[model samples]
Target: MKAVSELLKKHDGTLWHVTPAMTVFEAVEQLARLEVGALLVMDGDRLAGVFSERDYTRKITLLGRNSRETLVSEIMTANVITVNATTRTRECMSLMSARKIRHLPVVEGERVLGMISIRDIMDDIISDHEHTIASLESYIQS
Candidate 1:
């Protein structure tokens, strides 16, 4: 399995983020603009939390809180689960499945690397499977 670092290298290294003090409305706008399901909540260079569509729905919509008035920090998931660059994609898949989460922030010590989603993991898995199958077919032909 490929390491998380390899996967990050495949895509443009753009760490999309929102400040904790930003209003939920502003964060939501960023989400919409980026067409992403989540955004890392960063306090300067430090990761503070994660804000996602689920967080907005459950915390603001279901709770009847006003997004325009509420801060991202108030609704973001503070207990974020992270993975290091060396972590394998399969390990990340397992973590995401066990936690029932779609996004994970990749960090090393205090520095944030990037974020990965279920989509990224699934794509990697599918690619791996395809490669294996192709290898098997080639071996059989040989």
Candidate 2:
């Protein structure tokens, strides 16, 4: 099975991030503009935390925090669970499921490579199953 590294080979290893002090509202706007579900919080290119729409809804909105006043750092997931490029898709699924996180930063050494989403794994799983089923049906017909 191909790994996350293979999945990211075409992504140019570009990771979108925002400043820690950015307001939650600003982050949400960027998220909408970028059409991404999450953004990494960076401190001089160092991974600080992650901001997700879920964070805004759950930690800010539900908690009665002001989005324009609340900094993303205040609601970001500080304890980020990262995955290595070499990690398998199945492993990624397992980690995401266990932690209940949808996004994972893909790292190689001290540098961030890319981000992976649960949807990525789900698509890979579905594609693989379809291929396998097709191969089985072909064999049975022959």
Candidate 3:
């Protein structure tokens, strides 16, 4: 099975992070500008937590809280579930499904490496299916 390490190899090896003290508004703006759905909240190189669009919607918007006043750390999901680059795609998919989360931070050692989404896993599944079909067709032709 292909591992996350193989998939992460295509990414730019960049991890976008924000400080815990940043306001929810700032985090949302950064996420929008970056065209990303999540950001890692760093407490001086430590994975303090994770901020996601859902966090904004549920904790800030739905609750009628001011994004400007609300801190990202207040609503961010702490103790996040992370996977290493060497983790199998199946395992990653399983974790996402079990946790009902769409994003996962890829880590190596104590540093965040990159982020992977459900879309990335889905793309891998589609590619594998296509390859299998191609191989089957070749076998039938032979």
Top model number, lDDT: 1
Model 1 regions lying over 4 Å from their true place = none
Q: By descending TM-score, how would the candidates be arranged?
A: 1, 3, 2
Question: Across residues 1-81, which tens digit of lDDT does each residue of candidate 2 receive?
Answer: 569998787567677888898999999999999998999888886888899999999998799999999998889999999
lDDT of 2 at 130: 94
Q: Who wins the TM-score comparison?
A: 1
Candidate 3 Cα misplacement greater than 4 A, ranges: none
Residue 113 accuracy (lDDT) in model 2? 81
Superposed on all Cα atoms, the candidates' RMSDs to the truth, in angstroms, are 0.7, 1.3, 1.2
Tens-digit per-residue lDDT, 12-112, candidate 3: 77778888999999999999999988888888878888999999999999999999999988999998999998999989999999999989988888988
Prediction 1 global C-alpha lDDT:
0.96
TM values, all candidates? 0.98, 0.93, 0.94
Worst 10 residues of 1 by lDDT: 6-15
Number of clashing residue pairs, candidate 3: 0
As for candidate 2, its clashing pairs are: none
